[model samples]
Target chain A: MSKTPIRLTVNGLPHEVAVEPRRTLADALRDDCGLTGTHLGCEHGVCGACTVLLDGEAVRACLHFAIQADGHAIRTVEGLAAPDGSLNPLQRAFWENHGLQCGFCTPGFLMLATWMLEQPGPVDEARLRHVLSSNLCRCTGYQNILTAVRTAAQELGKWREGATPA
Target chain B: MKCPPFDYHAPRSQAEALALLARHGEEGKILAGGQSLVPTMAFRLARPASLIDINRIAELDTCRAEANRLRIGALARHARFERPVVPGPTGALLARAAEHIAHAPIRTRGTFCGSLAHADPASEWCCIALALGAEMRVLREGGERLVPAADWFQAVFTTALGPDELLAEASLPILGPDWRCGFAEFNRRAGDFALAMAVTALRLDVAGHVAEARIALGGVAGTPVLAREAAASLLGAPPTPDRLRAAAALAAEGFEPTEDAQVPADYRRDLVRAMTRRALEGSLAA
Candidate 1:
């Protein structure tokens, strides 16, 4: 297979790489861009471990080709932190609320939450649970993950008022 | 898993895409959202020699209500319908059904026309398309034609689409204010493929009786099947609880469900009955 040179803007930085047409965006981000924070649990779309924001929308990185993401703004877990490497609100909530046991699925969860919170309006508890259910978390049984997201949502003023917390 | 080696072509215009599809013929596959196609490719279930990516074609990314129908272009993503995109009962029905599709990430990139083109038996959009009598616009290299929903779906993972054709747009009838729609599906978990599902659309007469009813079932057959007998049973009558149950029973008894290791034939029949009743009841509540 011949390599197709494509430009990917990751975390507001432009990086040009030549990848084969068969290469997925997940692989290109991890191998070529050397950003391995975005994990790949299942190459299939069932697992949300490879979730990323493509042009400000959440999509499974494994399900999209590297060439398909060409010229699009790609955001990964590595882009969630400040320049001084301080934990963002969502990441801090995970830490304070014990969101992860093994931490393998944390990055995907963080990226997914980032996209949800960026949307307009407050997040209702039911709707938040529904959206967060898109990704699977095996270690913590998902209770703590839900708490972490709610905690972060409250801090960011994105949580709906009067919505009872679980 | 990695996709099988294939040449990629991103056509900037619909005409260019049609030309590429014509040239590659059977060896070419259209890539819209790639949510389903890319996964199957990664698993090596489908190894097309060429990929005709239509995402770059700006003309195809449209979803608009024109007069009596909602014109959904091939590039209309599923997430676009999370909220009612149009006014009336049709938009509400679409919003309700779209919420059941996969999840947020999958919906963000998956295209509605692509879902119809995939023709999965359990797809929510397929059931809605069949129930709403959608018209699919197919474009070949130099010609085009409209295919009604009845003639569109042939079998599971198959459709009326030809190897050299592209499903350019789908037009769903914009139901009137008098119409009410209900959608119900059974899945073990959120975002899982539905085991069985039903879509119902009813237009009430002045006396609040059933003037017209349209019902479609999914996941019980190779394609979404219209419940003609069940729908006919509800004509000229008010949908009481007992009446709904009888109609649901009629629907369940009419279908010869395909069995699987996980879902038995009788179990699917039960699901059909339950989903049909629930869908009908939901419409009445609206």
Candidate 2:
């Protein structure tokens, strides 16, 4: 089987790689692109471990082919930090709240939370809990993760308000 | 569990996709959203020699409201219907059902037509499509045909779609002003495959009598089961609690549910009855 040449922009970086047509986006990100922040728990779509943002919407990286993401912008956990290497609000909140126990599922949670926080208005706790339920974290039992996301949303909200010109 | 090696063709047009499907015939599989196909491939359950990626086909990514129906292109993601993309009762029903699908991320990439094509018995789209009498527009090499939802799904993971035919779009019948719809399902987790599900659409006449009713059940049969007898029982009668319960009980009649490791057949039948009652009551309340 011949490999297909495809180009994708990941974490604001563009790269062209030759991969088999069957190669999943998760494997391509970890192996070809060398961004292993996107973990793969249940290679199937059930586990949300490989969640990433494709064109700003969260999707399971393991469920998509690399070639299918040729012209799309993908954001992984590695991209969550600012260019100055400072932790983003969500990451900082997670750290302060002790959101992770083993840290294996943190990347997926971060990406998912990034997408949720990017939404229009302030997300209520109930809605946030519902959205956060999509991704699983076996160790944390999710209480602190929920608190972290809530705190991050408030922090982001304040930051956005401050950045706005009065 | 990596997918087996295969040739990938990303066609820019539906015509090109159809040509690729025709050329490869049974060896080709249309890749749209890839929610189900990719997972199955990763598990080595399905190995097509060629994957015709239809994501690039611009014409197949649309959701338009026709005068009498909502035309959803094959590549229209499930998330598009999570809200009232199309106004009115049909759109409301679609939004209700779409939110019940796996999750936000899965809904982002999973196509509504892809679910209908995959024909999963536990699929929310399958049950809603059957209840709404949606028509699948299939395109082949030389011609096209419309398969009504009633005749579309054949069995588990099977459809009336021929090997060379590509489902281009689905036209779901719009609900009239008098129509009210509701969808309910029981799953262990929020996004798990439904153990038993019910979708209902009801229209009451000016006299408060049942004018028309469409009830469909999932996870109780090989395909989404349209409760024809149960719906018939509701016709011309007042949608009272008694009538709804009797009709809900009748919905489980003549259906043989297979017992799985987690749930027994009897329990599933009871769920069908209970869900049917809830769906009917909710639809009326809506």
DockQ of each: 0.91, 0.74
Error of 1 at B236 (Å): 1.3
Off by over 4 Å in 2: A158-166
User: What tens digits encode model 2's per-residue C-alpha lDDT throughout A59-163?
Assistant: 999999998999889999999898898998899999999998899889999999899888776777666866778898979559899879888988777222222
Please give, for residues B58-104, the per-residue lDDT of candidate 1 as tens digits.
99999998988999999999999989999988899999999899999
Give the per-residue Cα lDDT of candidate 1 at B8: 94
lDDT of each: 0.93, 0.89
- Pick the DockQ winner: 1
lDDT of 2 by residue, B87-191 (tens): 788888888888789988999999999999999999999999999899999999889998999899988999999999999999998777788797889998888
The numbered model that scores best in lDDT is 1
- How many angstroms is residue B212 displaced in model 1 relative to the true structure, after the best TM-score fit? 1.2
Q: Assess candidate 1 and give its TM-score to the true structure.
A: 0.98
CA RMSD of all predictions: 1.1, 3.8
Q: Model 1: how far is B223 from its true place, Å?
A: 0.5
